[model samples]
Target: MNGHALVVGEALVDIVRRAGSEPVEHVGGSPLNVALGLGRLGRAVQFVTRVGADERGTRIVEHLTAAGVALTPGSTSADRTATAQAELDEKGSARYEFDITWDPVEPPMTADVVLVHTGSIATVLEPGCDVVAELVALQSRTSTVSFDPNIRPALIADPARGRARIERLVTLADVVKASDEDLEWFAPGRDPLDTAREWLSRGPAVVAVTRGGAGAVAVCAAGTVEVPAVQVEVVDTVGAGDAFTAGLLDGLWSFGFVGIERQERLRDIGTAELRAALETAAWTSALTVARAGADLPTLAERVAARKVTR
Candidate 1:
């Protein structure tokens, strides 16, 4: 809680269309969701992204501001805000087509930033991806770096090139999270946990893979720990993984594992602690899925849900 979080990536509006329902617009983007989630959890958050000075950009800023997230200067300099068309199936799962630009506002290098999070399009797309990687590398010296591929196959022009960039970021990150589907696409026919272990060996202190409905498993120095999913009524799966990432980071912060000073402790975290963190993350994702769009729960809401369950 004492450490500040800096989230850098894309922020776009999702134009969601569900069959038998009208299309809806929601301000979202993977890293934006994470930033908002952390802000709602009462974490000090600073977000950097490119959004045009348009209505959609205004909505995005209002959403972040309402959640208590600060927008870094120059974040709204893009010529036009990006958009993603999310088509939802009967099962509430979504498939996306993006019209996004990867360029992001550069954040000043500061000593007080204890955690740096970046991923998705910001890590693989041209021009900005390289900047994000370099920023992550520089931040790793003084801050804890967290990453999530959140791979959108449609956005990746070359699987090989994208995989290389992702792996390189994994080596720079202290914590990494990916979905089962993402892993399947990254390494066909391979178990997600195996990939988690491999990523852990590369550099990350914690490598977590989320399996929708089934649950999530994580690998750390102590070994692997798995947690069951929290049951919730389906709404739509937008920002679920980002919620998980935010919750995971929040749990780590609460456990004193989110700063450079605690990097070694994070590396040595035990299975029991990892399990508790993952359980919280599962609850966070469950709450997001139970709601429409990327509406995440606040800390009070998450705690109250746990209380009611107990």
Candidate 2:
């Protein structure tokens, strides 16, 4: 919580198309959303991502600035800004068609960072994926590394290859978060909790899985604790997982579980404490789902939501 958080990944515009509604644009990407959510929570966060010199890219810059996320130098490109055409279903679930590039130059290592976060397309795509993997490896010795495999099946060409790339980062992470749907795709025919436990064995001190309406579960060396989702009227779950990741990281920081010196103790954190963190994550996601697009809740809003839930 004391040191800055470094988030490395993609920044794109989401062209959301719902029934009877014109396409709406929102600045989003897994890591970008996480950065925005952390900023809204009052964390000192820096975002390292690529955006074009286009209008969409300008919008992305404004959004991050408003959220208080510092943009890393050389975060822009001559290439056109990335865009995802998201078609929404009746239940507010989204299917995407992406038009983007993923080739980020190495970011400056100039910040006093305690936490480093990355994943999604940035971890699976070529060129940039290797750069991101190298960054995580370099930072793991000093920071609490967190990864979220916010999978987009359409973007992946080979399941086996994607799994290998994802596992590589899992090995470097202190914390790993994934949705139940992601687990199903990553390890077919295996139970989500079982897969999460397997991830813990790989290197991460903790593995947290979000189970939609059923809530979320965290698996660690100590044990597993599950927290049910907060009941709320649903909107599109656009950035729910990213918000959850931010909340989880925030909770971990609050519990003094960040940085290399304290990471070893993460596995030994009490189940009650882990549950509290999971609850925070679930509540954060609930707020995202209760709205449209990836409009994450502010810290004040999160506090008020907690009070109402209580």
Candidate 1 lDDT over 1-310, as tens digits, reads 4668999899999999999889999999999999999999999999989999999999999999999999999999999999999999998899999998877767889889999999999999988999899999999999999999999999889999999999999999999999999999999999888888888999999999999989999999998898998998979999999999999999989888899989999999999999988998999999999999999999999999999999
lDDT (C-alpha) at residue 223 in model 2? 90
lDDT for 40 (candidate 2): 93
lDDT of each: 0.93, 0.91
TM-score of 2: 0.98
Q: State the displacement of the C-alpha of residue 211, model 2, in Å, after optimal TM-score superposition.
A: 1.0
Give per-residue CA lDDT, model 2, range 1-310, as digits (tens).
Answer: 4689999999999999999999999999999999999999889999989999899999999999999999888898738899999999999989999998898878767548999999999999877888999998999888889999999998888889999999999999999999999999999899988889889999998899998888899898789898998999998989989989999998988889987779768868888889888888888899999999898899999999899857
Candidate 1 C-alpha error for residue 45, in Å: 0.4
- Model 2 residue 279 CA deviation (Å) reads 0.7
Report RMSD (Å) for each prediction in the order shown: 0.8, 1.0
Query: Whose lDDT is greatest here?
Result: 1
